[model samples]
Target: MPRRAEPPARRATVRDVAARAGVSPGTVSKALNGTGQISRATRDRILAAAQEIDFRPNALARSVFERRSYTVGLITTDSFERFSVPVMLGAEDALGAGKISVFMCDSRDDPIREKHYVDVLLGRRVDGFIVTGRIFNEREPLDVSPGVPVVYALTPSSDPGDCSIVVDDAAAGRVAGEHLIRLGRRRIGHITGSAWFDPARRRAAGLAEALGAAGLEVAGDPLYGDWTEAWGRQATHILLRSCPEVDAIYCGSDILARGVGDSLRELGRRVPEDVALIGTDNWEFIAGGARPPLTSVDLGLSTVGRLAARRLLEAIGGNSRAGKEYVPCHLVVRGSTDDLPPASTGSAS
Candidate 1:
């Protein structure tokens, strides 16, 4: 064969793909990333051209061109908290797998820290924000940085349509309430975590529905407090004083259940016998270390994290059916609620 000249080097770009496909550069990107409101035939043509031209994405150049960091900002309270850690880890792993870098900020349960972190992340021009669970009321400082998609985990701001990944809190509470009732306990008390949090509110609502369905009222008003051992211990006393006849108590969290167990035993009560108990946030390894493991609702923390990250990646890749996503929860029964007769111990219990 006769000697031939080498092909000239040309930087691969959306423009080149557009030219080859007889379309616009905007159309080319939309097709490649599967985004933008475009016709299916046109998208197909652009994709075919991109493949033919061997277009490789230079993420660094793309970031510079778009004036973005291509990084996702994850803001959470209490990073060291056992439940939060698993969720954060799942999000990080999923994001990393999608070639996305994570920039994390811990609020440590302080609104000031939370606002500061939001400001910093906004300044960094992150592509998206994953707001983890924090107790922010309407009066709290709001972060309204435009042009970046925001995804929330565990909680969302008061505004509607904010994309979020959360477990159905009310459903979880209903599960707890139903379980106690099914166990033949007529008088059920409640030990709730922070009332300021929205999830706590939903849980209370769920508990009410469950009890209402069984034609039984809650033993008394729920003992409201934080999700701490101290509060759990304190609330147990209040619950007992308010409803001495209560035969079961649905705690807001496993930590609270642990405290309740301590209090019950101190008062000469036997778990699942004198007073059966149920809790949420099956933080089993840490909170359910008691002799008889605490029965709880598995809120699917890791699942929430993974789903949030996956949804974020999908958005970045141009899939835009974005809104709130909820992961369902199930009950994990242990010794705490085992007093139910063998015949009544259904699959859920």
Candidate 2:
């Protein structure tokens, strides 16, 4: 009453692939491992054979032979929030293309936790590391063995010798100021976060620089406060009270801009028609959700992550670069600054 079951098919092996490709096993190994000198034709033939037989190489065995785990450790202090997420995604995109796996760890701003993650990832023999966080301030270098490669993204390492990828904060402000200037807005007010933060100061300086180049000056000194909608609202009233002729306002963040916009509406000032608003970070959700979508500076967070990953890859390959590399910021046009419809997602030139 029982029926016989079919036998399981045998798995494909390197020898089978080599035989099918009419090449020696050694040649197949060379081709698959990307070692030694092999002609393109032979490599292609071996690859084709491996594909035809549905062959999958043993990752562990391959790693052993290559003496590399082909894995990277990504450590973040931002808890994968809005700032770090894009950077992480960009790093993943780059690492994935190299067939490298990533191990994500969150330090949550604790030194002990960061050290523990570093030790564990080192134990796993990850080929390299990418460190990222919310702020652009330089952080202490990651503690690791001498030979291990590490690239800092967004948040730079304090050591001048380490490679760091960062957004150009000054450029963000300069670009915003230039845009407002081009719109014939001579009286532009600056509203932003704390004065102690390096980025906030740099952005304020940049806005001043842009205004200066046009033989003009900001309507008033930059209103420095904590980064919040409430600050934005309060600062707006103050700025208007002192310089009611301010035709434009540039905020350090989209959240601040939203609050500023709300305040402007309450004060019976029409957006664009009366006072154009621009913000930083170009965070789509906050910028897009504003009554009139907010035009903001895109800090190229993803690009920072991608470049950091590339730099790490280079370091792993024995070609490392030191010092800081700044990715440029770009403007994203939106309803608040321009009369045109909302632009598509992501940063624009």
Candidate 3:
């Protein structure tokens, strides 16, 4: 048998894979790194060719994906407030699953502090960033150099081109309205946060749209105020006074729902039996603590963080996406709207 020829001294390069696979080096890289969109057949052919050459992807080659810092900076202007906590937790969970570390920074809604944290994170060489804020409004994009990927969560970037992940507030409101409508409640009322808040207005609009689609309207215009239990109580009084026949009420937040639930009791209305109540942000504590338990909309905050982390990973891998992405919202039913409350003290609570 003839002796086997010795291999070349230099290791095979991406060019070698491209030539063998009959594709370009860029396509070869994308296929190997799972970056760009390539047909499965081509990708498989490229991978096979790469393996046939005994090609080894070294750190330098991997660096094509920005050096695999495998780290992300999660900056929030809400100081880890209740609204932002679950998002952070979900993001951390996802990034951790991918063996990526996260550096959390609270900008406290201060532009100067946010800039400082951005600079520090950049110095630390984070591969990408996920900027979050309490309000569901468009905000100024982070001051970062081009090609350094950044994703906005909850709070989107004013630059519409930037990628943003946010809760589907409209969907939440629509779901709540549909749920109430399905229960045959035509005289519905709404109590929410300040109209100045984008979420407040969006939720109110969604509720109105859903009600309108059903050929009905809210018993009265949505009462807008701050997101406080006190506001909930006061708004409840006004909603009741204006719409005495109101059968169901939708609140913008769980806190507000809690207040409304208490005021409903004081006004001698039995939940679901006499009137139904629903709110947003299935915050377990407030929802569970509320009398008769609160039915609320789970805005999928964790889903927002997880999706943001996933998007950042793709961005770091050179498959960056743009525009706003809305995470779906869910309903958490409890005695507040259910005819019979759950017997166990679990998620239903």
Candidate 4:
């Protein structure tokens, strides 16, 4: 039989670029990343050599030398949901734009799996990590991966030493509460997320505060449940029965808001007429095109993702990590709420 052709040799590397550019491997890296006080001329020559030789930097080896994997770990509980995809995409887009890679892990809300991912990601020397789900408040001082910069998407796990990005859920809730109050709805009910999540708890507090400021209280005990449509529907039915005079309902999320609308219809009540409804997660893409639109609070999930990614990148680049950062939320009004005639400014219900 004819001899098999010899396999092609491995591709050129940063070492090759360094040799062709008459510089060191470190210099080549500086040129590629565009930093480290290297002269423009030297950087250009190094880049030219790399392009000529088609040099591919060894990511794993480079990570070893620099104590950086240039890889980010994204750990989430609900990793496969529509709401989470935007956040993951945002983070991936930001990091990948900088030529970084990502490793994703799902905790499935299991504490054991969550802790295991922390160790696994750290073992891989990932430059940073992004966590989403519930804000972990470090109920106790648990040792975590040392030197790994971590940021939370919506829920911030409590690590005072770590940086985090969160939406002003309290502000979102307050806005929703005030809007209903302004619409002359005095009897308002609330369907909120479980107290275990900080965002949900804070939002509920804000709702209460807003109502209190208006010289009123929640029409009834706030209905608490998970952040799911099923819970929202169940909570809505209970609220209606418990607070028969309620004229408005504030749902914790757009998903819940949709359920609330459905339940209202089933109860022979017209939305906005018998019970105006509001929810968080503007969910414009999901709610916008509905026959009657849904009003919601825009928590800026993409913004949170982008901000967290940027902060992680900055930390990896040796920037000083600071305390937590809170991103603001905006309210998007739609047809789910009443279409009252325009009112003069500064007028309260």
Candidate 5:
């Protein structure tokens, strides 16, 4: 014969909490939902009562009452790679602070997939959206309801009226150029990706501007090719062949810089001794892993994401603005451009 088990206690409700606080259920609702104003002391009492009983309000029921899901849709065309991941992470941090959940979707650069994601997220009734991509080019605006807010990060919307947060590509190149100039390295050569890419053209222009301001000029015309190590190696050979007097080189990306450095070593050019090197993107895995490390410019990708999140939150709050907003770039110095000890190498604005 087994002893009968005792019955479990019933779960507490709003009514129970209200009764314990000596107030009506309506007052408890106001305090819990932060809706109608209640006296500070009264609110505190109700909160304490709810806490004492370990009361957990029903989020689903509350969302229905408030008509807000407190959730956001984050869509990316880059498949969450090197560029979009940081942006998404930053957006998540800001949205999490607002007590909002995020539904991440990768479109894989497919228009049909992106449309499907937009439809699904709209069906879920997300509060707003944050759209991002790998490149700095303009993309078509998201196909969502007119009133629903959308903020673009890293990639601007084709519509000039939409809100966009992007990196200052020109600033990145200028910063690198100025740093090399500070080290008294004139006759700087520029090597980068395709001229067709907006970023590559902007960076080249920025470098030329910086050099012009210092009463100098680029050692030769910018050699643009693909954004690959092989292109970088090929471009370096072409640049050195034509401008052997080049005392410094600025590369569009750290990968390109690595190739340039390898080529320079083969040509018996000592980094920072015979030729200083500067790369963009400050990608630690590539820049920090180089033989002598690389002095590179950071594009502030995460900052762009955070700003986009903030802007989207503002739009959700009925305060929205349009147009592009640029985040500044910074430089991280290393042995490739400086003779300082490894321990002393750090960031410079």
Candidate 6:
């Protein structure tokens, strides 16, 4: 059989366009870019030649004059789990729109792997990096040399001088607590993940603060347990026995809240009617699918990603701001807590 045809030679370039247009490369550039005075006829000729050669301008080469690679490195430690995915999406939305490409790297929380990616991205001349994890806690700074900007997202840098974008866990709990109180549920209880997690502790503290503001205390000392539905169920029993008058419950996560809701129904308590409920994360499927859709606090993880990306860009632009930045969390009201009248449609009588 005849040898396979040679792969289409290399991609066309400015030189090829100039040669085809019977003009110098400098003239081709001036004409195509309209940056310098060039006759309309010559500009049209250069354009036609470029079209014929199928010239695809290299973004890197085109951006060379700006002294930037127009690229970024996005490093994640949680294998892009649910928590990190939204953050990444937000970062990509901001970066890609600015003509900056992102090189995604999953370090899987391995130090060696993270270092390798750092070396490779630096070699590629990435302008900056956004390091993130599933949980928004303080972590050691990346091993890259000084002068390279790295913004932490959903995770903070151990160094107070490094910039970090994180969720406001206290705000999440405060909002949940305030909402429950607004619904006339004064005897509130809080159950959450392990005490080791900053969010868990902060959320619990915030709830207590909100309750305190109203001259009421949490039904009992906040119950700390695993972030699981089973734990939610188990904790509910414990909380009820300890504070039999508990009228509402706030959980650290949606999954745990689901368990709380199930246990409450089994124990002959009506959601919102008897015991209002709230959860964190506001994950749609989990919150919306509940018997009475769960009310939850949205931690705004995506907003954290977006702000982190913006901070990285600012640093790359020579206006670096340091220290931890908190993004506010907001509550999403659903049927689980307050029952409202049906919405009215503008229909003729």
> What is candidate 6's lDDT per residue for 256-306, written digit by digit as tens?
999999888777777877788899998998999998999999999889989
TM-score of 2: 0.94
| Model 4 residue 112 CA deviation in Å | 3.3
Best by TM-score: 2
Worst 10 residues of 5 by lDDT: 340-349
Q: Which sections of candidate 6 miss by over 4 Å?
A: 1-56, 340-349
- For candidate 6, the per-residue lDDT at 99 reads 76
Assess every candidate by TM-score: 0.73, 0.94, 0.79, 0.77, 0.89, 0.82
Higher-TM-score candidate of 1 and 3: 3
lDDT by residue for model 1 (1-349), tens:
9889998988788889989999888777777666689898898888788889898878887788766677988887755656557678889888877577888888887878888887888787777877775442322224747556767777654555566777888899899999988888988888888787777788888999999998988888977888887888888788787777778889888888888888887776778787898888888684468758888899888888888888776666666444566799999989889966422211110
How many clashes would you count in candidate 5? 0
Worst 10 residues of 6 by lDDT: 340-349
Off by over 4 Å in 2: 1-8, 339-349
What lDDT does each candidate get? 0.78, 0.91, 0.86, 0.78, 0.88, 0.87
> Between the candidate structures 1 and 4, which one is better when assessed by TM-score?
4
**Model 4: pairs clashing at backbone N, Cα or C within 3 Å:** 135-156, 136-157, 136-158
RMSD of 3: 8.3
TM-score: model 6 vs. ground truth: 0.82
Q: Tell me how candidate 3 scores on lDDT.
A: 0.86
Tens-place lDDT digits, model 2, residues 1-349: 7989989999898999999999998999999879889999999999999999999988898889878999999999997488989999999999998889999999999999999999999999999899999877889999999999999998999999999998899999999999998888888999999988889999999999999999999988899998899999999999988888788899999989988998988887878777899999989999989878899999999999899999999999999999999999999998888753222221111
lDDT of 3 by residue, 1-349 (tens): 9999998799888999999999999999899778899999999999999999998876544645656667789989886488678888989888887667889899998989999999998987788899998977899889987789999889999888889998888998899999998887888899999898999998998999999999998888899998999999888888888777778899999999888888877787778777789999999999988878889999999999989988988888789889999999999999888754312111110
lDDT of 4 by residue, 1-349 (tens): 9999999988998788899999998888888877799998999899889889888777777678777768888887775565466678889889988888989888887789988987887787777787775442433222366666677676665666667777887898899999998988888889977877677778888999999999989978888888787888788788877777778888888778877888877777667777888888887765685446888888888888888899888877778375678888888888878666322222111
What does the lDDT read for residue 112 in candidate 4?
Answer: 91
**What 10-residue stretch in candidate 4 is worst by lDDT?**
340-349
Off by over 4 Å in 5: 1-49, 339-349
Clashing pairs in 6: none
Q: Comparing 5 and 6 by lDDT, which wins?
A: 5
Error of 3 at 15 (Å): 25
By lDDT, rank the candidates, best first.
2, 5, 6, 3, 4, 1
